[model samples]
Target chain A: MNDDDRTAMKKRVQRLVYMAAGGRISEADLGRYDTDLRQIGLDSLGYLNLLEGLERTFGVAIDLDHEEDHSFLHTIDNIVRYLVAQGGEAV
Target chain B: MNGDPTRGPIQDALTDCLGRHRGRRAVVGSEALSYDELGGRIHAAAGWLRGVWLEGGAGGRAPRHVGFCLGNRPEYVILYFAVLYAGDLPLLLDANFNTGEIESIRSDCGLDALVIEPAKAARLEAPGKGDQVPFADDVVLLPLSRPGAPPFEPRPATQVCRFTSGTTGRPKCLEFSGHAVVSAARNWVLGTGMTGEDRTLCLAALSNGLAFNTSLLSSFLAGGELHFLKGAPLTRPVARRIAESGITRLVAFPTLYRNFVAPGGPDRSAMAGLKHAISAGAPLWPDVREEFRARYGLDISDYYGIAETGPCTFEREADHHSGLGRPLPGAEIRIAPGPEDPDGPEETGEVLVRTASMASGYLNHPGLFEQRLDADGFYHSGDRGRLVDGRLHLVGRTQDHINVAGRKIDPTEIVAVVSALDGVADAVAFPDEDLNREALVHLVVVAASPELTRAAVAAACRSRLASYKVPGRISFVAEIPRTGIGKPRIAVLREQLNASAGA
Candidate 1:
């Protein structure tokens, strides 16, 4: 992923972590926020909401077939890795 | 078609829009929209849909089934009525159905278009990619919601399709027609003695029958405001919304009522204005039914109907009969005069009904459609019931009935007995074929309290029922997995039993 793509992905993830927390966690805790995915308080619905939020923010269509392949979406790291591997290949 | 019976169905309902009617709250989420506002929205939605079809691009290609994949929103209400005005069938989809299932349904039904909640639309696998009728977040806005729209005639035989709760194995789509919708709404209105003055509190999701037809459409037809509960922890909030909204009537399934009446009941002040309460979807135990009545001073009107057929039968307000009441107007009830006659009434066999409110058939599956509706037009309900003293008392599902030693025993009777036991919260009894001679297996979920042993459950079943009818084996569970409507997942329970047996 390019520097801008990486920046966008990071920002998207941060926004997602906040939205999924649903006021349970504050913005001030963003620096100390757990990027372990589970500690971010993203439940299944929250995870889904995050995906939708990312799609809307990036203005990119996510190929559902790829995102749900399980080799992806296990963690935020895997998602970023998948994105890098795709190299802007429409997902 | 544009005359009395057609317009009359919704005209009187629209009449309640005038200020003379009593103010009662129906839906509670972001803001409680008044009856005037709700009615105005319905009117405006109808008009907007007409304008879209007439002037804009929704073009007239023989009005097809319009799918509504929306959640509990004011826009959903507007869209529902808009579809009605368009003379199109509104195929209601559950908000909880996974993307795969939802897509399957959209394709299966060949939905002309879909109206999704703007908020929920994004979460869909592909929102804008599919044939979507995108409405704004403020789709329920006032000026957009006018009633004076050009009349369009709905196809006389058009029906709405829904997937049957497929505990029997594969889910089959069931169809219900415009005639059925009107008839069911009218039956409920008559059954409950609902008036313009009676506002309704709907605790169930807009997708389920209890809330969908009975509360939403029925209330609209009866000139009653339908108040919706926003989320879980229903009792307190629903009760508060009802009191605040002046909702005189409440309709829900047994499980929902059970949740309310469980430990510390709903705040008395929250439900003081409520007069009528009804239960359906699952059998309400006599004790629980009585308890709700004693607590609320409102008889829990027992309702009986399946998704295949809309609201078919309801308890008469005049006499609170224990049995599922007689068939509603324009509905026929048959006891299935077969070779076998049970011990109850003269012609009591299986409860078969032919109703105007009955669905045409499963969507796209003509084989299932034909299988469900016989040559005589009677829908074989697959439910065992008896017509005693002219009222039908549902025994249980015919599929779940056990044939043990030349005797037929319904598992409902066994489950009922088990459910009555101390510490037992819920129970499901099914015939275990893996066991010899088809012995009934009972799975019990006990409340958090004194531990309930299998022996205790067996003993309780033995005391209440005959030895053969008693469960052959018993299993304890933390909680029985239930459907959204609160019916026990008997098939799932059987699967778990089989897995354990294999182990």
Candidate 2:
């Protein structure tokens, strides 16, 4: 994907993370794309909601068992890379 | 008899169960274990536990308190049984408990040893933490040196203990007898029509009462296979497990059911083999139930159970979708009339329950559990519900405790944590729903200074309390409206907050 497209996907992923957070983490705290979502209080329940949002919004089904490496979900940039790699484009 | 003279009723029953289904699969997770293999593993682990305690000079003492602080897995099951078989009290603790909570439990209820993950043991800063003995790949037994006797003691009949969330970071430990635990399992097996061929996929934590009552001993009593998923209870993976494993029963909470009905969820064929989808912990939403039924052609049975009372009710008829089912075998429900109730035939009152599987009492807080019981031995369930056509229909809880995703959290705990922070004048925490209709703890704080932000308050909560106890939503307010009696007027405050947000 192009640089601009990549930036757009990261923004979209950030927005989804905020929505899925359910107010557990402040939007200001989630601004950095490289920050670990878990470190900022994104708990297990938040991750469950985030997976649902990813599937509903981008149609990306994350079978956690199949993924040997879970770093793709660790940061917004990583999630953007995975989504783009899976042919998910900015709507 | 399994050749053990000191075996209690629970151990004997479990030994008999294993013998009856010797070659059958017992627990399935990352690996599967047959009944015979499981028995052998439990025996070996128990012997190792005996040796460890004996080496620690605790052989002749009272039953050692062995706390389980791990998640649901095959090893967890084996170790729990091992602790029991070694003639020690198994204290099942929530795996999500923070270091502070564990320390509090260690202080309140004497912990002789803890079966926990190696990583957690490394970080734990308990006062009496001793040598760590590795049990499984990720599990270890970390022995603790008891400084002195605990303030309170378990009853002689008590064999196991579980916790309920309490105020100010102290969880109340409820004691249960081996007979009570066995009664709950047997009744569950009989009431739910569990058979030898049934395969159960349990998504709830084994420490929680929902899974403890339904999945743990009951699955073995019925000679069924108990399965545990390794990771998060997402929709696709859960559905795949059910379909691939031919799982007949799904014991989980309501959030999981809601996910199955959401857009892009697994298809109906994925759950074709699921015969019983039991939802507990929190109440299942009506819309989610209807949607799931419409989509999957299966009704999610809304299970009604109390922390003090084991399995209370189960809906036998799939067509009967309203109310929390009839009482299970060996359980009775009584709805006492409220003082303000009319003389109508059907009156909604406080739910009182008497079950053969009732807890003995709370070990930490003495006389607290007994204070809730009446002359008839019925424990007054703080819930307000009525009996409709022999089914229990809950309206709301009379207490102020907030139920967030089935875990009851004391709002005072949240308010106390926030109030202790600098620049915080007053605060009130209450049960609130997010945009997705999920239950969350909403902490509304009246900041003394403009510099005190939501992030500051959230960070304080994260550091001090357990993750589930942390506030989901933090909002700043000018002042908190209180009644003349110094009680928070939550309804009025909610209206004001809603109006201000709209403005």
**Candidate 2 residue pairs in backbone clash:** none
Q: Please, what are the lDDT tens digits per residue for candidate 2 over residues B1-503?
A: 12332377788889999999999999999989999999999988888888886644224557889999998899998988887888788999999999889888888999999999898999988887898999888799999988888888898788789999999999999999889999999999999899999999999999999999999999999999999998778888899899999999999988889889987788999899989999998888899999999999999988789999998999999999789899999999999887754653467888999999999999999999999999999999989889988999998887889898889999998888899999999999999987767789989999888889877788799889999988888877788899999998999899998999899
Q: Against the true structure, whose DockQ is highest?
A: 2
User: Candidate 1, residue B158: CA error in Å?
Assistant: 1.1
Report how far off residue B193 is in candidate 1 (Å).
1.3
- lDDT tens per residue, model 1, B28-140: 45666666666676667766666655544234445545666656666777677666655556777665444555555554555445676544554556333443344665232
Model 1 regions lying over 4 Å from their true place: A1-91, B1-40, B46-60, B126-156, B166-171, B267-269, B317-321, B337-348, B374-376, B400-503
Provide the fnat value for model 1, as a fraction from 0 to 1. 0.00
> Which regions of candidate 2 deviate over 4 angstroms?
A23-26, A55-72, A82-91, B1-6, B55-59, B340-346
Q: Lowest-lDDT window of 10 residues in candidate 2 chain B?
A: B1-10
